[model samples]
Every structure is written in structure tokens, then in C-alpha cells.
Target: MWVEVLGWIIVIVLFAVGMAGTIYPILPGAVAIYAAFFVYGFMISFSPFGWVFWTLQTLIVALLFIADHAVNAWGVKRFGGSKASIVGSTIGLIIGPFVIPAFGLIIGPFAGAVLGELYARSSLEQSLKVGFGSLVGLFTSVVAKIVLQLLMIVLFIIWLLV
Candidate 1:
């Protein structure tokens, strides 16, 4: 009993941490949520809906992670950014974790696109356009992930309540 209770607490904490990870580049938010669900389901012995559900959830999370990165790159490319801008965006994303809280998340991607464009072609106007495109793509990706998280939460709640 105590172990189950402990599991619940740990899972909740991990879920929050994972969500935060989604914002920061270093952590995997969806994975955290999936892990929490996985653990809780195991503790309760909720039958087939338990582990199988979470395994599928984990797969979706993984797909979203990949899709997000790809879309962001595509967005930059759509605006004529070269390989340099893409590389810069990646660097900016990595650097974002260390700087100003949530702001870094936005700035990092934008800076990366701009820097990438500047390096690739030395054109300020084109760089700005690429940055803007990248920003839009990033925003869309965030929305999609958030929606996915919400769906997972809803499914968990429904299963638990029903």
C-alpha cells in the first residue's frame, strides 16, 4: 500500500517536471507524462488499458518530438534559409535553456534562424523572413504538442473515473 502511494507521489512530480521539460529543450515533457501514467497504471493493475495505453502514448510523444523539429526546420527552409540558419536555430535552442526563463525558448529559435540566414547568405531581409517563418512553425508545433498532452490527460481521467 505504501509503495503504491509513493508511486503516485513520484509520478505526479515527474509529470510536472516532464511538462516543464517540454518548454526547455533539454527535457522530454511528454515522456515524463507518459512515464507517470505508466507507473500509476502499473500500481493499480488496471488490466490491458494500463501498460498498453501508456506504450502507445509514449509512441505518440516520440512522434510529436520528431515532428516538431522537422516542422521547425521546414518553416525556416520555406523562407529561403540555408543550412547555416538551420544550424544556428539548433544552437539557439540549446543555448535557450541557460538564459532567461521562457523568453529564451522563443529567442533561441528566432536567433538561430536569423544567424543561420546571415551566415548562409549575408542578407538581413531574408534572414528576418526565415526567422519569422521558423517562429510560426515553432508556435504551431507547440500547439500540437499541447493538444496531444491534453488528450492524454483526458484519456487518463476518463479511465480512472469510469
Candidate 2:
């Protein structure tokens, strides 16, 4: 009983951290949440859900993980970003957490977009727009992840209670 409570606490903490990480680039936000669910499910003996549920959940997680990267690349593509831009934006995202505080996450992607657009079109204004668009795309994904996390939590609760 105590172990189960401890596990729950750990999972909850990870979930919260993942929530913040979803915005920031340093942390593997959705991955952390996905891991938490997998842990919780297995720890609870996979009681309510059968093999099918676990398999489907795992597949969904894999797709979301891939989507995280693909969506950003798509954002850059939409703005006519070059190969360098895509690569640079990825680097910027990595550097973002260290360079800036709260705003770094938001700024890094835009900076990357700017770098990408500049390389592709040689236009500062257009690059800025592309960067902004990428930021919007990232924000949208984060919101979606939050919604999914909430739904997952509710499902877990329902499974446990009923």
C-alpha cells in the first residue's frame, strides 16, 4: 500500500514537471507523461485494461512522439525554410533553455525560424513571420498535449474506481 502511494506521488510529480517541459525544449515533456502512464499502468497490474489497451496506448504515444518533431519541421517547411533553417531551429531549441529563462522557449524557435527563413529567402521580415508561425505551431501542440494528459488522467481514475 505504501509503495503504491509512493509510486503515485512520483508519477504525479513527473506529470507536473512534464507539463512545464512541454513548453520548454530541454525536457521531454510528453515522453515523460507517457512514461508515467506506462509505469502507473504496469504497477497497478494492468488491472482494468487488457493487452489491447496497452498496445493501443503505446502506439498512440509513439505517434505523438514522432509528431512532436514532424510538426516543427512542417512549420519550417510551410515558411519555405531551407535545410539549414530546419537544422538551425533544432539547434536553437536546444540552446534556448540555457540562453534565456521563461522566454527562451518561445524565442528560441522563432530565432531558429528566422535563421531558417533568412537562409532560404534572404528576407528578414519573412523570416520573422515564419518564426512566429513555428511558435504558434509549438504552442498549439502543447495545448493539445495538455488536453490529452487530462483525458488520460481521468481515464486512469475511472479505471481505478470502476
Per-residue lDDT of candidate 2, residues 1-162 (tens digit): 876787788788878877777677677676777677766766655667766555656665676677777777777777667677777677777787689887777778789878876877668877776786677667766776666656555655676677
Q: In candidate 2, which residue pairs clash?
A: 85-116
Worst 10 contiguous positions by lDDT, candidate 2: 148-157
- Candidate 2: which stretches are off by over 4 Å? 41-44
Positional deviation of residue 11's Cα in model 2 after best superposition, in angstroms: 2.0
Highest-TM-score candidate: 1
> How many Å off is the CA of 46 in candidate 2?
3.0
* lDDT for each residue of candidate 1 in 1-162, tens digit (9 for 90 to 100): 987898889777877776666566577777777777768867755564766666767778878778778878888888888888888877777786577576988898898889888888667988999888878877877777777776776777776776
